[model samples]
Target: MSALILFDFDGTLADTAPDLAAAANRQRTRKGLEPMAYEALRPVASQGARGLLRVALGLRPGDPDYEPTRLQFLEDYAAGSTVHSKLFPGIEALLSDIRRRGLSWGIVTNKVTYLTLPIVEYLDLTRESAVLVCGDTTAHSKPHPLPLQHAAREAGFSVERCVYVGDDLRDIQAAHAAGMPAVAAAYGYVGEDDNITTWEAETCAHSSTELWSAIEPLLPSDLR
Candidate 1:
């Protein structure tokens, strides 16, 4: 059977932090909080809304403004989702390869549905993705297997015949919990000190080119 490749959106395939960081700063400015630098927010791109809220608004879990602040951030982000977002270098080539090889591909991200749709569309990925499982699509998000498992099922692939690639530890955790082989995207938003080697990844691809090289062999020889 052919292997199905499931990719994480924010850090793995796209650089969406610029728009997200801009939204975070906008929220901060409205709240009279100091704006944070874009670089500072990059690492948390895959961490989702709450993490950005914490960095930009400084809202604790119990803070009364937290929910409202998060809502505002989401609204602003939706408007500016693709302002600066783009696929990583070599990603187009890799995606082209996947399609040319007739391999199934899909996205499973912790990004909420509304925001995720715009970004995916902006990247022109709508026609290419075979399945999509957003953060709110399932009851639970990453670090939980339900989303990935559900995505695999919907894609008509067994979990064992699939491979999930993502940048964060939680991505690895979720893939493992879902009974799929996981790969760490080393070229993603990972910090220098973050130890991806410790995770139970099938392998780590340091760049989109490297990811292509690694996965090409796993595909059928005719496809390769």
Candidate 2:
């Protein structure tokens, strides 16, 4: 049977850190603080506004300044979300290969629809993806199985016939909870301290170039 491949949007399918970091840095600049290095900010990109705000301003959710600052940061991000965001090297080819193999693919992300759709369009994946499930698309996000389960159902695949790929530990957790196999994207913005080995993915792809090899083995013989 043909299989379904579901991917996380940020860090997995696209290198979105440059633009995410830029928004965080803009917050710093407005406060007369020098912007943090891109290298430092990139690691927390997957964590979204909460992570970026903490890094850029040392502010956490409950802090008095956190909510307003987060709003501003998100506003800044929405304005230029696609400016520096692009698919990781080899990703377009990888998606094409999946299609040629008669497999279907979709995106399941914690990114909200408003924020996710624009980038998906910018990367020209809007028409090609079999389904698009966002944080708001379900009641819960990653680390919860709802989003992944929703994606599989929307794409007409059983949970066992799908594979989830992402760079975050939560992605693995979600896939496991959904009764699907998972692949860790080691090339993505895995935080500096994260050890991908312990994420318990069925296999780990060190880069987009290695992804096909890692994923193909996890598929049924016919699908492979």
- Residue 64 in candidate 2, Cα distance off native in Å: 0.1
Candidates' TM-scores?
0.92, 0.98
> In candidate 1, what residue range of length 10 has the lowest lDDT sum?
215-224
Q: How many steric clashes between backbone atoms does each model show?
A: 0, 0
RMSD of 1: 2.0
Q: Any idea what lDDT model 2 has?
A: 0.93
Which residue pairs show collisions in model 2? none
Task: Assess candidate 1 and give its lDDT.
Answer: 0.85
Enumerate residue pairs that collide in model 1: none
Choose the strongest candidate by lDDT.
2
